[model samples]
Target: MVVHSKFQSDTVLSYSGSIPYTCYEIGHTWEPGCVKTFFQTFCDAFKFSIRVYTVFYLATFVIKLRKKENRRIKKIKKLLRDILQSSIFLSANGAFFMGGFCMLRNLIGKFYGWHGLLAGFITGILSIQLERKSRRGMLALYLMNLAAETLFNMAVARNLIKPIPYGEVIIFSIASAGFMSLFRQRNGLPENLHSPLTLIVGPEESRDFYRNGGNFSQRWRLISCLPYLQKLLQRLKTVHRSHQSCPHNNSCTYYTLEGIFKQFLLGYGIQILLNALQSLRGKQKWSKVFNNISLASFLAGFIGLFRACNCSLRWLLDRDIPALHGALSGAVAGTTLYFYRSTSIALYFFFKLMEVLYFRGIREGYVPHLPSADQYLYASTLAIILHASCCEPHNIRPGYWKFLCGVSGWKFPVMFRKLFDVFGTKATTLYPNFVPDLDPRYVKTTAVMELLKVHGKWRDPTNF
Candidate 1:
């Protein structure tokens, strides 16, 4: 669907009172000069975003820092610049959001929920240009994941839809199944993109095996650790002859186990580091740290089961129905979600499936291609987040709310929100601890001192 940004929408309701900067919270300091605000917002966002972007991009260096075209010093400089570009992308997006809200209030004569949408959408188009083109689709995809979940929760809250048990698992299973099916059909994985399944199932399953070798797609790269175990694996040759259609080398058991061990160690290492970081905050749960093997086992089980099921079913049936076997095995493997459940992981794969399907549709002439979908998705997602942050803080994911707080330089608490009650979102009621002076309707009301109250003991801001 073509999502055209406009002031008029079906969502419009009460137009009472002014929606100007002073009347409502725009989630920023209401200073003059959009240009100045943009730069100010940029610096604040950069301080936080650089640390985040650096951590995120850190793995790239660890994985392939040696293959860069630039020299050691130059590579570091270029990487810093690249990271800066992303920080700017995030900072500029927030600045533009504030600017857009202000502009919309003035031009439209009032503010509405859709105003956020319009502003977000416009800024998305403009700001996306500053981001690396390669990352645009990925950014859009991530936001789409968040948007999809937020909308689902909203629907459930409104009683528009019933919640399903293990819904995320179901979604992940289907998506993974679709992915495996496509991979087997030799037309699913994106060109030149590294797929995680390559390590699990091996490169023989890949269509561009020659081109993709050593490009983070090979199964052999990670399993070269543990010299003693390596010696043992080297001695054991293929125990079972390969089925004619088998896209793997050596015995099936060895191939399957190698992936399991590698992935297990990888997951364990990651979880340990995370646990250590959490420990640094003086909240060390020493009681459960050693026993926290769920992540490791889950990763191992994921690939172990997938390889075992696929190979066993293939050999037993004596024929490889690529789609059927691939899908069935994928579903079976996804059942390991019981080992470690994560809505975030499942949702990520679900959108990945959507991307695969959408692209496939375009190729097969079954779907209309939209060139600007990524930009729109990113913008709209941000719009939803900004709107909810002020008008319905209770509805947003707490972590995301904190993220907005960081990026906006702690502006939400200072934002004027009492006029926000005009929209009937119950902003004051839900987030009752906002600054006392924030409510334009009434001044000098005592703000809650606790700051982080949920249910039992929150000071209500509505009491005049």
Candidate 2:
């Protein structure tokens, strides 16, 4: 009869009850050691890259198809070319980083949690070189956002830092304010810098920024209050109803309600679609449509509150300072983040704001232009993510973790944690959730690595 205990790899104390040899590291029995792991990872990355690129590029192609300006055949060709480029960059990036980890381990005969950082850094610098230069900056910015959040979460987990109250709200507020100012002059900027506010507030209305009605007549302030009231009422009733300083061509009440309804529907539709996706994944009941209603409410409330605040400010000052209006209204609208409390969205926008500002500085000659900065930042951020994911999985963002798992062929869980335990990362605590790649109960025979749903027989992990 076969004897079993928890798949402990740290010690070799038993024969039948001993930890499997493959458990000593990540590679499965059929693919023992570092060299085999590299080849295995290469295959996984290649297959996953095609699937990921198809999904992304297919959606883009469908969107571009709506615009008749581009020839259909040309668009299809572009799509195929982009997908090819993407696959090469992504496959190489994923394969090298993952295989790099094992490669690094082999050099020293053992690996620690921090070794993932070195592997990631080397792989990132090398892999990014294969990517299109035009795409590097955006990729760097996106990775920077994830890295910042990961770093902060890790710090909090270690009690090295405390969570800030309403921090995301504050960050979103500042970034949104800056974005609004930029959006006002978007005509001079990249075509892709569109904001949802343009759709909700009306393009014409948003474009009329910095409009200032001259101060009210002193005579009206002293007397003829009735005429002044009449003038105000007349302005509200007119087709282009708005304070002289206001931009919209509608009564404040109409504009406010219109924005509210449209924005609400926009947000609601998005949330519903997300819920539908979740339902497909069997994560939640589809009937519970209102379960995450606040996510929609956050967007709807933001539009309403922002317009109300901007109108009030204009009415109070009897004029409009476009800068003040944008800043204050954005700040007020930012409070809506409290409805959903999404740390991820806020953190992303914070990095995005910094990126935009830095770019602006470069254009204005205030910031130095650094070539390859994007790749460097990308490498640095990837290292942080690699180190954190390996050493402190608990701190990684759930979506990011899931994405990493998919890209890595679910190998994150199968990583041999016994060596990492030396770093005092509390890795053993996470060990129970993941089976070692070489567990006797579930030996892998083929190159395709999948975690089977059924647990054949798990021996209660015994302490060595």
Candidate 3:
């Protein structure tokens, strides 16, 4: 059976001491108000970083990095691209955050004994499909995820191992969607205009295909879309017998860059407004805002059902999977949230160290193989710091854990132990069983020493 003792709490409340330190009178002297100060400082620093990165991204274009040859056109193009890209990024991020929020909400309900969790799960699945730009791919991903989820849930229900917590499920779903994004990167389209589109079939064609279900029916239905099919050719000949040039066919290769720009502008204008409003409540500083916008845009430009799936998967399972010692694990988890940011700022400095060391190599002029090498490293490093801070032992308390489970919105028991085990291998390495040869005092402060000391010791019964 599963059990939770100290974690149980009524009405979620914030507490800050030595973080998770339980110093009941006869314990070590602890910092009184450091936790609250740390959180506030972190947020303020993060906001500043976001502002700097945003300014640089906009500045780089304005300085004409892309179009140095022509001053006038450079300004126009730079402004145009920035506006268009920013708009797309904001909208996609809004969708991403919202989708993730809903996915987590559903998972929480399902894991806990809430009646509405299953209902929410069904709605989330359908809503995600409807929200996707590609119905076919979305349907495919939905079915695939549903299968995985059903099997995983069955295993949990039967007590084959441990019950996966709602937190882990939320993380897994988001990670899966992120992984799908990586695979969905388009190799065919140009960098600028590769937005995804939905595929639709006519009504009459749908009916005819249902009536005759053989190979012939399939071939004929597909041929209907082609203008050069034998049936269409005969019909065309009957309609126009004249072998003369038509007025509509007169030669003209007029190109309107302005029209293309307008099309881009109009579509993005509506989109940006929606996104900005969605994210208005969580406004950070300029650099952090910029980082959020750029990262969001990069993900947006590669929009598709597959990418969404990638993001979801990464959120769900990335934490569990072992990679490049502890380096890859931290980088993957952190970078998923941060890339394309600036240093000097606190969050940037913190997260970037991870990116530069673990993920990116500065050989020759570029960090090869990795996607968006520079941005990824910069952004990921920042994210690692933020995540570390958020999940740190000191920042955590019984109330936050309850709130994280959505127990108030829907009181439900989640198997966090099993959930942690899903990513146990990676987490184990991070909170290693044995201390290294070096002195503990000399190790990097960012090693999450406090968290490691607790979970690490817990992993070994003999050590206790």
Candidate 4:
């Protein structure tokens, strides 16, 4: 069952003008660079949203307040710089390795197989290299990644989670932060480099554990007043422990039945409400901003779905599915959704609405009709439910993609306009509302953090 290269096959099949069919060319759809480029674009887009709406606004409010008479302006300024730098790095590279390896698998289909066994191995190794900025931090990232790889291998090798639905891994991932590297850092700093880090956000007790000296901020002081934070975390801990059951072998990890059930109910309920909202509101500035968040989340979710489809296809065909499936899936999904053609478009809109409402949008200055500050609690509840509902085996229909319009929407025209322009379109022109007028301090501090990792100055805070 050898796959004949086009060179060997005299018949060349090439069609254009939006014919619905399958693609076989290796680099045509799944080229590694193509995969990376789309995700990079996605990350940058979302990064703007995070900065302009959330970090920038909050930082300005904190810096401008005349009420804090005791605090010096210089200190406020420094804190602002630090917070923005850390957030940018996290948003930019938060999903870097997952997205990177997915890209690489597509690009190097010759080397990697359907199970992504090679991709996982390569991902495990490369994560240590590209992401390594500090020795200790690198080590920690390596260990956490190793744990992830081991779990993936177990799932493949023993079929430990077989017929368990492909998205179960994602559920486990979100619940445990399995794809993320975690350790004790001064902030959510990159373990491998010094230039960028997310400011570690937690309950006041957790903050107390990380902070030096007795000094604290007024805002944080208010956070400490909430007595329920620790109680909630303790409950989470108990649930986490229950999910940690070892099934004789330590090869794979998955969501707890409780976590899965809880998340599905809540997330689905939120999604329903969001979908209802989409029916009512036309695109406005705030709505557009929220829509972008929805769009990005939709893209991410589609990627997850495509990955599952490819894995399942590999299993069914008894042949290694090409990485191009990953690339092709992304391109197809994006092109399809952007053009408003595919049936999945409906799913995309619904899920995207859910994503913005529950996970990211509200954090970035979106306020609901409700005035309660306990929005996060509700969002969290929604996230859990939607995650579970989306994971249901019945929700997926991978092969059926017939109902699609070949073209619609302005995206294609806009792309063509850029392609033909002698003078390039301004980079910031597309997302005018979200562009950040960033300071040099944020860049400098983030660069320093990454430099430390690349230069070998970083040590894992957890190790100490």
* Most TM-score-accurate candidate: 2
> Which is the better candidate, 1 or 2, if ranked by TM-score?
2
Q: Which candidate, 1 or 3, would have the higher TM-score against the true structure? A: 1
The per-residue C-alpha lDDT of model 3 at residue 326 equals 21
lDDT of 1 by residue, 36-118 (tens): 65667667777888888899777686676666654488778878888989988877777777777767766776566566667
Question: Between candidates 2 and 3, which one is better according to lDDT?
Answer: 2
TM-score of each: 0.78, 0.79, 0.21, 0.23
Q: What is the clash tally of candidate 3? A: 53
Question: Which tens-of-lDDT digit does each residue in 199-297 have in candidate 2?
Answer: 655453355344344322331353336877656644544534577766765567655655666677778888888989989899989887556777778
Off by over 4 Å in 1: 1-40, 72-74, 191-195, 204-244, 248-255, 422-424, 428-430, 436-464
Q: Order candidates by lDDT, high to low.
A: 1, 2, 4, 3
Q: Once model 1 is optimally superposed onto the true structure by TM-score, how far is the C-alpha of residue 200 displaced, in angstroms?
A: 3.6
Q: TM-score of predicted model 4? A: 0.23
TM-score, ranked from best to worst:
2, 1, 4, 3
Residues 1-464, model 4: lDDT tens digits: 11223222324222111111111112112222445544654455345434443655466666567567527778667656655544443333223323443455345432112212233333334333332243323233223332333344334543556543433333332321211112112232223321211121112111114333334223235434677954543354344221122211111111122222333344455555665566567523333333323333343343334333333444456543233333333333333233222333333333322333443344655654444323332223222221111111112132210100001011111121111111111212332222122222222233223433443544454454
RMSD of 2: 9.1
C-alpha lDDT of candidate 1 relative to the true structure: 0.67
Off by over 4 Å in 4: 1-70, 91-111, 114-158, 161-464
Q: In lDDT terms, how accurate is model 2?
A: 0.67
Q: Please tell me which model should have the higher lDDT, number 1 or number 4.
A: 1
Q: What are the Cα lDDT values of the candidates?
A: 0.67, 0.67, 0.30, 0.31
Clashing pairs in 1: none
